[model samples]
Target: MQWEIVVGLETHTQLTTESKIFSGASTAFGAEPNAQACAVDLALPGVLPVMNKAAVQRAIQFGLAVGAKVAEHSVFARKNYFYPDLPKGYQISQFEIPVVQGGTVSFLLGDQMKTVRLVRAHLEEDAGKSLHEDFAGQSGIDLNRAGTPLLEIVTEPDMRSAEEAVAYAKTLHTLVTWLGICDGNMQEGSFRCDANVSVRPKGESKLGTRCEIKNLNSFKFLQAAILYEAQRQIEIIEDGGVIKQETRLYDPDRNETRSMRSKEDSEDYRYFPDPDLPPLMISPEWVEQVRSEMPELPGQKQARYTGDLGLSEYDAVTLTASRAMTDYFESALAVAGADKAKPLANWLLGEFSASLNRDDKTPAESPIAPELMAALVKRVVDGTLNNKTAKVVFAALWEGKYSDVDACVKGEGLEQISDSGAVEKMIDDVLAAHPGPVAEYKAGKEASFNFLVGQIMRAARGKANPAQVNEILKAKLS
Candidate 1:
């Protein structure tokens, strides 16, 4: 009785506009509760909603980035519901027709390329927050987030595992943030994910009863919740129990899900087009304007990196994982020349990444400037400094003790002993001083060669290029 897991994700990304989607109220996060909610956001009497042009433009930009079709015409509908935080008693959202449609999100899972087909993306207004903390036996409503513009992107049930689903979510996060539409900040509720998960017998054509896991804010949590929910459903089916289609919440402390309520279908909302808002229309000229302003997206950059620059697929994908990181790599390459791509990527993805994580920093907050990294990479390639000496140079750059790589090398006295004649003299000195090891090497004890090389480096005070030292040692030993 082998079972397979199926998953689909619906992500709500808060747009980067300065105001709410249907009102001019400020969208700045962390304001006092209910203070920022204007008459329109508050749904006061005699107030009418007006759509934000900037939010729409951002949605268009996303559609273009993901290769989705931007709908020329769409409609806003009122989703009838009862909730304490929903001031309007109904949410304004796109129902029958959405702004964007039919796109695929591709990302790497390990070395394999995985793609998730998107159903559609629609523009919607976010509901306010219901606060339970800091109140004694009573609840509070924070209307500050009311009317905030969100782009709800839905996907088909094309994912087969938790890893694939998590990968899809991460891929979408990268695309949205790269497009500059959303901040992609899970901590601030700017980006949230809901997963619909089910389990069915292997090779079965019929889908199993599905449950929706609500509002997983972090990637780790998203993966954990899906795995837990899938197991829960599989266990129930194996135990001769029925799986109910309900909404569940992941309890991070317990690492399980608890049923919140039954899942509702689209008809349950009783959706109808709003009379106050006309049919939303988009112009080709506007779409073209957005397309023109778009920067090279991640996929485009990945292709160019691999095809034009001759980088490996893995290196290209790692380099283009984020827009800021790609910008950093390009800026470094600009200073160091494009030929340095492989080594530059290695440093960026290896030591540089480790340093960033150690310091709990991002590429934007990195102390090492792009130009400085380029200079460091150039020095390493040219034998001006080896990896060890370059690390000392990086420390200086990180501390701002030196403004240039050359200055850092000079300040720390890390200049490589690359002079051929000088290296030859040091190797000769080592061979003469270490006669026993030199004899061992000449007698076919190949392991003694490394000892001779180490002796030469020590004679040169660790400044000699090991490659040059090895060459000079080999010549002397012969």
Candidate 2:
């Protein structure tokens, strides 16, 4: 029997504000434990919580970016929970009234564009980290992250496959980062997701018992965890065993999920409006101001890249995936011109991405300047260096030492060998060595022609102009 997977995601994105949500403490990561924590963050008695204006502004910015309803009045509620990491014993979050509601994020699943509906995005305070190391028997609690501002974005169960869920998550991550509402740093726990997954018979209307996978920080893991869990649930139900609704943790090393605990329902939290803080009232003027300042989102940027820049749909989507990459691409294109767009796209997505992967750095941390990349593209276009030689120059540029493309080309002696005499001599040597192949080519064998081309390229050590070599070889053979 065919099974259908139903998936929903609750993503927690830390706001990019400089200060904590309810305290004057710094929200910086990697600080000394408890150094950034203030009295309010410690949840000390007599310390009242004050909302950060910047956090509210960022939430509004997100609402504007996604075309969601920005509520003029929103309230914070106390989510009662007990853990070593939660200092206040109850987290201040939104329950019934959230800041943003009813937005949709559209993304591509291959050639099809699918829209995932966002139920709501609410403001809340982050819990602290529990350290399991450096203690023989007891764990340590670091309150540094406590009371940090977070935007919990909950999406409707619109995805069917794990790939779809991951694609949707990545799209939302890019959107939040591009809108400057969040940093979207998955490694530092700045951005995280909890996926609720279930499996039912293909035509079954009622949902199956679902499991929630917690703290998935990467896209690959998110896909794998959901897939593993869905298969496991399907197997259990097929074997005549009922599926249990529980919380699971993804063990990436094992490529499986383990049950953590039974999933808690909403009523278990006993959510009540926080008495310490009043309802947040944002004026329409504030929302409009943020809306006017909202940058071009990924969807709009993708359309512009394809329509205005004349890039392929694939290239446009890839280039507009991140705001930093898009900015770098445009800056380089402006200097390189429209004629160099396809080549620039290839180099950025190919060589540039390879370097980024090798160095484990993001586009924001790219060492090569856009102007320098443009210069390299210009060198290739103007024939100062061939495509093969430009790769070497690109490596130098990526190391941040090469200031001039001309100087690098000259220093590396990578000038294209366009001399007809030199190319003809090399082609003559190849023809003399491979008479049978030359005869085969003369007899209309296409493979022999490619073989001869490879020999010519090897003879020139990738320095010869390929088109010119092909022309000269054909003329000499004729």
Give me the candidate number with maximum TM-score: 1
**Worst window of 10 by summed lDDT in candidate 1:** 468-477
Residue pairs whose backbone atoms clash in candidate 1: none
User: In model 2, where do residues sit more than 4 Å from their true spots?
Assistant: 399-401, 419-435, 475-478
Score candidate 1 by TM-score against the native: 0.95
Give the TM-score comparing model 2 with the true structure, all chains together.
Answer: 0.92
Q: Would you estimate the TM-scores of all the predictions?
A: 0.95, 0.92
Deviation from native of the Cα of residue 129 in model 1, angstroms: 0.8
- Tell me the whole-model lDDT of each prediction, alpha carbons only: 0.91, 0.90
Q: Model 1, stretches more than 4 Å misplaced?
A: 432-448
lDDT digits (tens) for residues 18-57 of candidate 1 = 9999898999988889888999988899999998999999
* lDDT tens digits, residue span 1-478, model 2: 9999999999999999999999899998999999999999888889999999999999998888777899999999999989988988999999999999888888888988899999999999999999989899889999999999999999988899999999899888988888887899999999999999999899998888889999999998999999999999988988999988899999999999999999999899999999999999999999988888878778887888788778888898888888889999989999999789988998999999899889998787888888888989888877767778889889877786678888888887888998888888999999999999999989999899989999999988888887788899888888
Candidate 2 local Cα displacement, residue 321, angstroms: 2.6
The deviation in Å at residue 7 for candidate 1 is 1.1
